[model samples]
Target: MLPARHAAPLQKGLLLALLLSLAACGGGGGGDSSSPADPGTTVPTPTPPSGLTPPSEADAQRFLSQATFGPTQANIDSLRTVGFKPWLASQFQAKGNLYSTGYSDAIHKAGLKDFCKQFSGFPNDYARNNCWREYYSAEPLSREFYRNALYGPDQLRQRAALALSQLFVVSNAEVEGTYGLREYQQMLADKAFGNFRDLLKSVTLSPVMGTYLNLVNNSKADPNENFARELLQLFSIGPCQLNADGTLPGGQCVATYDNNGVRDVAFALTGWTYPAGGVSPWGSSGWKNPTYLRGQMLAVAAEHDQTERKLPGGGTLAASRTPEQALDAVIDALYQHPNLPPFIGKQLIQHLVTSNPSPAYVARVSQAFVSGKAYDFGSGVRGDMQALFAAILLDPEARGDNKNSDPNYGRLREPAQYIAGMLRALNASSDGANFYWWWGNELGQIVFNANSVFNFYPPDYPLPGTDVVGPAFAIENANSTLARLNLATAMLYWGGLQAEDDRPGATGTQINGSNWLALADNPTLLVDSLDKVLVTGGLPANIKTGIVDAVGVWNEKNHGATWREERARSAVYLVLASPEYQVQR
Candidate 1:
């Protein structure tokens, strides 16, 4: 029999029900868009493109699992029939989804007007109201994200938005109570499939980015270097020159900029501030209303630094004398840097497909980021977003591994990915809003709520078993592993997560196990089907045998009211808890 979820203290930073608001996520934001078609309520098989050879059913399931949130049977069938290219094209055509409700709903929930104003003269009204907007924007946005990833058809855009979120990081932890944090996330989503250069500028101007990085009200009198440093180091061109394959040239990396260069970039970034009065829909919350975050900060010409400056990689900003011009020059220079291509290319591949992508794989993606120009969504004439992403997914290295297994090819799925994949695979239903799961307590990652600019972990985190870098492993420890086990066990048998808060509540999410129980009698068949959704067919044969043997012990006579269901739950719980399903290949 399978052991039950431990009766131990629950993890911290957890809430009973998921806090969902109308907001944005990395893959959900307004940055990039795929198709014009909406993700209709029901998911149906797409019309397979003619004259294209589809991948095998197993291969299709494997690819879809990695590419989307998790593979749906309908989507899996569609991918196999349409082939990779057409399937991708169809995904590109899917439209983005946003909150169905308004920001006012959040304020209404706080009920400040009825209770506080009626009872007492509230001095902390500013702080009070700000909390409402931020609270609603934060978790509710994640619910929307999960809904889309699990059921929405815009899988590619969602994946791209997630990848962009990691790169251009802005956490709800940092920018709460400001202009709907959703806009910042939407900015990244809107640009995920757009030009990288455009994404950088948009992020630089975003209110959420400004708050997170302290760049919104940046001034030349005493410049803030935080955003500038991260912009060059993390977002645009990295500090070191990565070779085409993403390794140091001859194992001796070269620096692109020095201290003076960083300062110059900082000085160049000055002259922007939150909207005037700060209380308007899109500016910094002001002295009048200090708590509310406003819209994207606007550039102030008077505050601009009009001095000579040195550009990164040996250039002068002589031509860029104004704030906007200077900022544009800086962005263009950073985008064109040779390092930007491979630096971002490798990380993008790591994020979407595998952790330790081969140098050849890195090079292939790098080329796409640089030279691929087959398709364009009309954002700009330069660097087609569609082309860049298509290269990463359709490349021989990324897809070829699906045909031939590479022992060292997969990534350990991050906590959020693990939780999300489970929900998506099981086809869990939710209200789309107020859907909540305390992933941070168990997995150390909440939707858009990273603690720092570094994101959940450093991209170059080295795996414990090997010296190879694996970003997702940074959160992988005994405690978290145990937490994952607890979560898997609870999800399988307990219906879903419990509200860690004082009040009793639903997981804001639950899956119908009827389909699961149908195949409970044959452990092999049951396990194989789940493997496609959970592990993408990476479960080793020996591990499969172990799981089959372990789950077979639960039978009708020994199990509960829904004996077949209990057996199925036991099988899924074991597989989900196993080390085999934790990593993604």
Candidate 2:
């Protein structure tokens, strides 16, 4: 870490540069809008634009910025060679990274005393803390998440699963363990490219989500409305009535449901309990069965409320139906809601592409979600995620030659994306066992540890001093902005984290400045090359000139033996810390 004293001057300089850059570029923000028509309006299919003829390296990087954690030279090469559709096909079929939820469960079964015995050198207090982190807490799981993001082959799936996790929010704050959390995330990854309905069902039945949303042992006498309300508010059809294109009617929001509706859904969804297995290490099972995270939550008929309830799209959930049947109805109602396609589509667009997509863009994706079928790897179903993802990524708004021209077309890089982008652009190497995961807390988006169900930032959060809404900017403040620059300085100038025996797997995260020494001799070439990799649409001429001039100062004759390395590091550090690179277009 860079010292506070050193960081102060650097922070001021970088902040001034960022403000100037932002002034030059424009403010960043977004909004939700679609169609003025009814929910069932069948939008005309958008024409598929022709692929880029021999895609440019910058274009490939931009696409990968949206589709994957970050882009690499190899991935850019592959995309440039085969083009977009074929590359997407390969990614869809590629094997995904597997989480070790089962292993975590095994660790839990063995008890904390036996599990902590592996570590030889540690204080007495260290044993329990270490054991809890490895076996029960979210530490190990977070490592696995970052590990896959850095090195996994199935990049699109990883990105998509991450997007899904935020929408169907669950946090380690409540469900504190590796087993259920990993299982919930794995379910998301597995079903990421599958049907949206199936993914919804899996999330609903997931013990992890159940625990988080208070859906585990819902009582018939008095129902809890936490999951039911969020199901309508955040997960599925948002609290407002939306058109087929996701726009609010009459240029104003309308309530989708009331408190009564929440109670009705909650009562309908009663009578579920944890799966049958695993001893609760904490020794408590008063309201429900002992904690179990392996299988789906089981139904308990005795605890079920058999009262008739109203569904989302104006349908009656019969009182005669079983708890399982009522659940099926609830899932069906949510899946079939017109707001689902655009609501989900727009958010996915925000996550992957620009924050403020045009209503026409949302309409096109919504149409694909409603009517488009996935012939590649799906069963040609209506709610096909494969088809949905294709619509979002391959849309005319997402691709083509007009990305950088529009002043308002981009998102502020969330901490996670910022770190990943910096590392991937520089050809950084790591085993994913480093301080990067812990740095998430510092950067304000810890993986599985969101402050609440609202996530690290609200999806529609407005950019301060701007009318537009940039979700990631919700975490962008003076402190975080400085922290970002300091991190860049530490990684580039001072050495990044070194591999040590204390860390799991003894693996470090690093980028080699020496590798860029060849290009560093020529400042213009070095700056241009780094810009192509790190900045979408390349850097502004002024910014590029400034960096090139700065890099040129470190000459072989005057700056001595470390001149080349310093030049390279300086070039990287300047670009990464620039406002030009912070807002991804």
Candidate 3:
């Protein structure tokens, strides 16, 4: 029931060609040095800054802020030699074998090919292959912990908690055969460096994303607004007028909306569809198997709705338009909007680097976006990844060091971040049945199974009377809150420890055998590890003290060896679950 804006056929062809050219040319490469280096070889370390033997706390924090999930000891060591800026530049241009080889191979083996094969054909005989469906189809080990909370043995709880946490952040490589998978992996492997615009286009046409956002079946006649709405509201320019500092004018609270603007933009996004010659259904007569054609989400003229549409505020476009005109208009408007740079740049900083970047910091990042000095992947000037990392680490506001009672500028780690961090930390593989088991439950972020398209939780859930943008204030009702608390407790006791090692004939033998406190006995090590992996270098002393005290209780009671491990594990779960972890600056 939304208004529609169909582009002229001529315009569609022109835009499609332009996009193809840009994609082929790698867009405008941003201004970073284009000298290629061997991705397979490690760069030699630089001398420490003026007699420094190891990285300082500041150095560690900077490293953690930009890397996906958390840093490994190896990763930290590498950063020490390259220094932050150059290391960041290298990440932007990184190539093959960058991820752990074992992990990468296992991901490849996880029926990803089958999934890709199934998704290649759409809107015809092609079977639907929902990633979420695949994930939940298997009964992950974390579920047992949930069951234990309700009826099973209390002793089995901590194992489940760790499994859940692991599941929360791990990225699945199930897109192997799908056309979009390669592109997405390229973006990720590019060290989280790429053009935001290119990333947006890639996500728009990706089968996983198309399925996630319900854009697959969108047609001219019955134009689905789901993708269009989110593209503007969550993924791009965002929903309001804003100052350059990322703060809204008039000091308005979070969750404000430009309802009319959303509607107008959605109208312009009409008429997008897959290529002509509809895909063949499996076993159907005259049906042909569909192959993935790169850049093939074409606008079918016959399928397009050419009705003249009224804009939300009051304007009209001519009827029977082409796809190019419609899409270009929307993208251009969004790109030029004043709100875009600050709004999106801040979110990227929040997701990739820090929680609470200062207004000035946001301004600097946004300026890069606007001026085309940063995030311009076409020129290869350090793609979105390099610009974003620079903004997060180098910006003065981001490095503000007032620790005593400073307002926390971090975001609550989404389930994905938490899970991925754990898997990376454990060097776990997704091919095993234990995939996503340890972290998913602990953090409550199950991949491919967000509760709604609004996502696991609203990005701007408001707090009581504050209208402040923080953690899950919007969705944390009584049931959810209780669930969260119970989830936290369960994670500590059951999710942290792994189940009896699954070696054949292992006979229920406990691994790390009931000594939950073992990791916690050395509070310094535990804290340091958590700081290294979870908080980067930015954990508050008070928070560290709380974890230490909790560890003490576990140690004193001679808690089961398993319980001891759970307590130590709980320290991390607790930190990740805290309010401070959820709100990115």
- What are the RMSDs of all candidates, in order? 9.4, 3.7, 16.5
Clashes of 3: 88
Q: lDDT tens digits, residues 1-585, model 3? A: 001112112212423432332122211101212132221222221222323344454454444534434455556667567555555455455343321211121222332334435434333332144333222222222232222222222111122122222212113322222223323333333323455555555556554455445555455545567776777677666666676667666667444246555555555665454333323342112212132323435554555556665433234655757756666555555556566667767665555444445555566667666544532222434224345445545554443333213343344444444444443443332322232343453445544234555555554554444324543333334444334434434333343333434322222201121222345667666766666554544556776786667655655457554444545665655554444333222
- Candidate 2, after superposition: displacement of residue 179 in Å? 1.6
Backbone Cα, N, C clashes tallied per candidate: 26, 4, 88
Best by lDDT: 2
User: Candidates 1 and 3: which is better by lDDT?
Assistant: 1
RMSD of 1: 9.4
- Assess every candidate by TM-score: 0.82, 0.92, 0.59
How many backbone clashes can be found in candidate 1? 26
**Per-residue lDDT for 340-454 in model 2, tens only?**
8888888898898887777777777887888755224245667888888888877767765556666777777778788777777766676655433557777888777788998
Better of 1 and 3 by TM-score: 1
Report lDDT (CA) for all predictions. 0.64, 0.75, 0.43
A best-first ranking of the candidates according to their lDDT comes to: 2, 1, 3
Best by TM-score: 2
| lDDT value, candidate 2, whole model | 0.75
Q: Candidate 2, residue 456: CA error in Å?
A: 0.6
